[model samples]
Target: MFTSPFQDYVIDAAQRTVLFWDVMRARGNQYVEHTAQDAPHVLSYDFEPVMAGTDLPSPVNYGLVRIEPPKGVKVDEAKRPFVIIDPRAGHGPGIGGFKADSEIGVAMNAGHPCYFVGFLPDPVPGQTIEDIMKAEVAFIEKVAELHPDASGKPTIVGNCQAGWAAMMLASYRPDLCGPIIVAGSPLSYWAGVHGKNPMRYTGGLLGGTWLTALTGDLGAGKFDGAWLVSNFEGMNPANTHWSKKYNVYKNVDTESERFLGFEKWWSGHILLNAEEMQWIVDNLFVGNRLPTAEVETTDGVRLDFRNIRSPIICFCSHGDDITPPQQALGWILDLYADVQDIRACGQTIVYAVHPSVGHLGIFVSGGVAKKEHREFASNIDLIDCLPPGLYEAVLTEKTEDTPDADLVATDYIARFETRTLEDIRALGTNSEEDERRFATAARVSDVNKGLYQTFAQPWVKTLITEEQADLMMKIHPARLEYTMFSDKNPVMGVVKSMAKIVRSNRKPVERDNPFLVAQEQMSDMIIRSLDNYRDMRDNAIEALFLSIYANPLLQATVGLSADEKPPRARPGRSPEHIELVKRKVEDLKARISHGGVREACIRAMIYIGQPDSAADERRFEFIRSLRKGVPGELEAFKLTVREQFFMLLIDESAAIAALPDLLKGHADEIEQGIAFVRQVASTGGEPSDAVKERLSEIEKVFNTALCTKR
Candidate 1:
């Protein structure tokens, strides 16, 4: 007998309801189990502890562990190791290596040793950021000790919040780090477009960060990370309030495992010392000091980002609402007035913007892991060899039309294309008015914080005992949401049994059922309504913030003038820096004609490849294939490449003209060298007219050198 649509709907709905409740119960049970296990991280790979932060002089919850490569994976100890630091913003660490397709996986697959720097659920008493930095340096030193034969220092990757920490570490000890990659990190705090980036307005709407201070005080000197997670959820109301639950309700059987897996990490909220949290807010979020070299250590050393000597790679995404392209790339604009400033600092900065990935997806998404991360890991050497300047990392999938396809090692072709400050500005930034408003907000925050500390903090701290703080954390909505649905709840026992019975006799409605279609339409309507509400709320907040902080009277009260320049306006180059640049330029000029066959070959490749304004793996790989032996140690070769690149940059004409002199004694090698460069020049495709012209110039130089030798 065929049932009516109503009957089908009733039966299917009943089963789904039971299954949804069961999934929630399972999630609760998993949370309990996870906590019982002391919330072991979600890293898919097994690991052995290398060093514990607690063992250091200034103890911390952080630890460094070495990952054991999975079956069939071989690690080369001689290759530079990879040390990944996952963000400890709210959740526990291991997001960077929680699955097979992750940062750790990519490095291991590439035959590099991998280490993870993660933290425990709680901080050591009075532990500070400086202590963590010390631990990080020690961990790196240990890695270096372990890999004495490695060709280069470890490549450090910082995901999300760890991005800033890694940058600080690199700036603090540039000699200890190799390439530094920061994924989904916001270095420039006040950078965002009006109307679109509402998160930047949040602090202003809240009247600044005094609330953060109050929360830390109320928590009895320990900040509960659940509050941070709650703030993140508030950014997307539809997802937090309805869609995530509805997804599981709609596809309970298939989604439960993935949901449980993610919840293992998402629900693992850690703690931070009140001092640590307060320092982060006052120095970074509100003070906005890190980018401009205003942040200093307790010992008084300035943490200037320009001091970082290694290649810095920024990976962000357009679709990421949290760390948008503006916030990720804006610091470049803040620190350097022009590309020459970057080159003067001897810095190589590369950035990659994903077209549509979300913030977390930049680090955790499998597709990104396979493509972007993989390409980055493989082409790191190319990045290291690049000259000091700004470049964009572009990855394109290989195709049959690709030239010299056989020489390509990976499935994608990686290119580093030159970029300029205009490109970063084009991503969108705050106007002058917006800057004034943010500055006003900062000033207001300072006043409010002072008031609270003087008036409210003492009383709150005195009244809020450890027991009360513990109770408050237990009853927090974020934690309660999981606890209330667990097997410990008497009502869940009934739902659990019902779920088993329903699973045994499942009755799923067909997709075309009128009731099912109606259900989907209702869901869409609900989602739209919530999204509209979110948009309205954000707009109102933005408007309110501007009205309160952007007023001329209020700006004046905050000591901001109508003619105040944007916060990111950089001062002119220092006299000392200018002298240094001049000296470096002169030094490079003197070495224009001081290289052998290897230098000539690298310079020729760089010169010919200059027309495309890009460097590709195919060309680099072809060069490697032709070399019967390495010219020297990898470090020496890197120095040679950098020297030649700078020589070309400082005086391309002189550098190319002098190449014939350097190749004079190697007349017999001239034909082979030219052939090698020509083949590499054509690796990506048929050489463009400009590339062909450069190649002809190289040929003429080589021929002249040969004739001169005769």
Candidate 2:
């Protein structure tokens, strides 16, 4: 107890040094072992391929596999199937089901049959983006055929890059799709703030798709995904170089497995054909044409997003720098004029925003799986039943006990709240001027692309060989870091032996050790330094982008209008289409008075809950329980209710006026319906003033109807 402070410090420092070396030795061995284990392909699911893309007419290396449910999880084929398409932006597939608490696991545990769309390490010769889309549509069709008795169409979940692919498929072939969940997918590429998101500016700063074409040519027509992975790592230098490794070193004993597991996925890079990569860059990333309906297939099919009829659910996070909420949400603003336009299009759009999860965490985090994914899986049918509108899916933790607590399955409640364009605009920090700058950048990109394709591409392709491309991929910085510490390195042999000895006689310093405290402080300083550099670099890039593209003279030189304005709507719709929509609207209005008690009740409920209503798990459970013995099947009844409710919402005043006729001489039924609605509204907690007012109006409608009947 009376020992000198210097003596304690010396002992702590020596112990930390020993632990640090041991961690390095262990990490070296792990790198070697993970590399060997995943030599061919790394997949988390135990699956059998139902349709291999390589065998299709237009062969690609991707495949559709059915994920075998783990023990204790029974899947009901009669329930809607779930198809999860993992993102293949840079890495190999299977992150969506890499663990038990994942998207696939969540769907399987909820008794739904699950399938996965995954790809191999190499892209097929001459494979294009259109080929991949065709393959995915085939997989979806196969799943639908297999689930003939299912209540509804299969629910497709697409992660990151796959999310946009799913959207394209839904737009092209809406009949074959169901409710689609797109998590961490960027539909609006150029819709980021000035200082916060700098990746959006990279396409502009680098000129454009010209670089993508150059990289592909340098790689002998096969684009290296390592470049994409490197870009992602560069976004967060603190995580890539400091925190990730530091966390493992600090908790080496307990974190070895988790660290190695993730590194395997992170390091498993895949390839894309030059054509595929160029199409993505030209049409999606640099061009920003997907949302505007300006992109078309080779066969002349206009891939308009408005063609999609299935409900769309977008999951994003505010903390996701790669696919920030602005990029994830901006497409809605681009595609629709206003809320009324969305309603007129008859599309139900819902989004959920996580407060602090990163892009990868949106698909792979266990905590996210247990909460958000769980709630989404449980409420798929409810989402399908929601009326055509823009809503935010809000998840709240349950705190107090309620009468229906036992009926609930999860600890959180999922609610839908109405949102508007203004709410979406608030997510970005850009003005009309910023948009004009982006437009100017797009114009510059077009010029650079034209010049490069005509002058540079032929020479670059002529000099590149298959061997040189392979060598370049091998020496990529992201890959070399792992290869340097592998067993093949002669220096790692000694490290392996020393690691074994250290494991045999392991000793750890106490948490309060003086030297350990100093070490943590040093680590924090290093991280902060890297973060500061990143911020400065991003700001500089933004400033340079503005200086080059935002100048009116430069914009005019590039053939852009000098006066800055928001993007104008592209003209493509036929006059016949407008006439058809008018006819449909008149037909919809004519059917406003034709419905039964179930329709009347559900319509009244939606009308009363219109302002903003939140529902807990208990509320959903109660609704399900009330429909136990109603009719042919629960889904059929729910579909009918949804159709009628949507019709009512279209013509609210007329629907309300006609409600008395629908429920004539049924006073007891009307009273029961109001009581049920009140009970459902009370499940979330005490109602807000708006909710109370809506409820009062609903009750007055029924009361007046009863009085008139009497």
Candidate lDDT (C-alpha), each = 0.87, 0.81
Q: Which candidate should be chosen as best, given TM-score against the real structure?
A: 1
TM-score list, all predictions: 0.97, 0.92
Which candidate number maximizes lDDT? Answer: 1
lDDT per residue for candidate 2 within 337-374, as digits (tens), equals: 78877776778899999999999999999999999999
Clash count, predicted structure 1: 0
Model 1, position 243: C-alpha lDDT score: 90
Off by over 4 Å in 1: 567-574, 627-632
Residue pairs in candidate 1 whose N, alpha carbon or C atoms collide under 3 angstroms:
none
TM-score of 2: 0.92
Q: Write the per-residue lDDT of candidate 1 for residues 1-710, one digit (tens) a residue.
A: 98899999899998999999899999998777776665468898899999999989999999999999999999988788999998989898889998988999998898889999999988999999888987898998999899988867889999988999999999888899989999999898888887777888888778778999889888999999999899889988998999989999998868988888888899988899988888888878877778888888888877889989999999999999899999898889878988978988989999999999988899999999999899889888778878788999988888998777777667888989999889999999778787778888888999999999999999999999999999998899988888899988999999988998999999898889898899999999999999999999988988888888868998898788777676445545668878988898899898788777888988888888888988787777766565424533566757887888888888888898899778967878888888888788878778899999999989898888878888
